[model samples]
Target: MITKEDRERVAGWFAGRLPKQWQSAPAEITIDREEITVRLTIPDVDLPKDASDAARAEARVGRAKAFREETRKQRMEIAREAEHRYDAKVSWGLALGDHTELWTHIAAPVMTRLRQPQRMVLDTLVDAGVARSRADALAWCVRLVGQHEDDWLVELREAMASVADVRAKGPATR
Candidate 1:
């Protein structure tokens, strides 16, 4: 189980290890059981006041691609070290202006057992073309729930973390 301290330590490590020139601000680090994603907000592209939306978007994409190619070696080395230390794969991304791009992130498969009613729900989504398969339908459903209940989920997570802290302070089990 990952604790809040573990997450903070990983973020702090990346902040100190990353080159100062790579990002204008501290990297945004997100960690789960299988992967750690580090996103950096780089300096924005400067354009004329009358620049069109297409020009701005093109510039952002160009900048992101160039940055990815230029920093490939350094990023790989950092990822290798991080992966070893954290026992998880490392994915990287960059944010420029309003555009963000993530690459090489894990899509770990999940396993679950559902009754007929639950299975029907997934089947309905697939039949309606909302998802390509049961797996996709399940993923869509989870994303929908997350979007709708984000605040409640956050509160629940906080409560769970408090429980973990309390458990840690209790007597050791045999």
Candidate 2:
């Protein structure tokens, strides 16, 4: 686990070279598998209070592009140093534009085939206002079960591994 000191060190190194707008933005760092991913939230542009929506949108895109181009080298250097120090691949992302669009979690769309009963259950959830859509209702249901059955899930995984091991062994000799 990377310590707070390591996080601070990396953040400090970038604060100087990053665009002024990003200097005060929060830096979020996480490690997955063999990679250390760093994301720096971009601050909102300092636009006039009377600025039009179109102007605000344009400013955001322009700022994000400029900031990315300006800091590309610095970001690479930071990633290199972080990879060396942590002995893991390092990646970086800029939290640009609108907050929701910028920080959305990256997930691949999944295609699933459900039985009639399962489909009806999800539909029922939506109709009852349990969730906004079938996808959301399914996600909520997953979260509910995951929260309640964490221990059961863990034990099930362990048992499956044990079974796999037992099956790998050839029939025992008497």
TM-scores, all models, native as reference: 0.93, 0.46
**Which lDDT tens digits does candidate 2 get at residues 25-51?**
656665543666667777778989999
lDDT of each residue in 1-174, candidate 1, tens digit only: 777778889999999999999998889998889999999999999999899999999999999999999999999999999999999999999999999999899889999999999999999999999999999999999999999999999899888778877888899999
What's model 1's TM-score? 0.93
- Among the numbered candidates, top lDDT falls to 1
* Residue 27 miss distance in model 1 (angstroms): 0.8
Task: Tell me how candidate 2 scores on lDDT.
Answer: 0.69
* Model 2, runs deviating above 4 Å: 1-21, 96-174
Cα RMSDs, all models = 1.4, 10.8
Model 1: residues with Cα > 4 Å off, grouped in runs: none
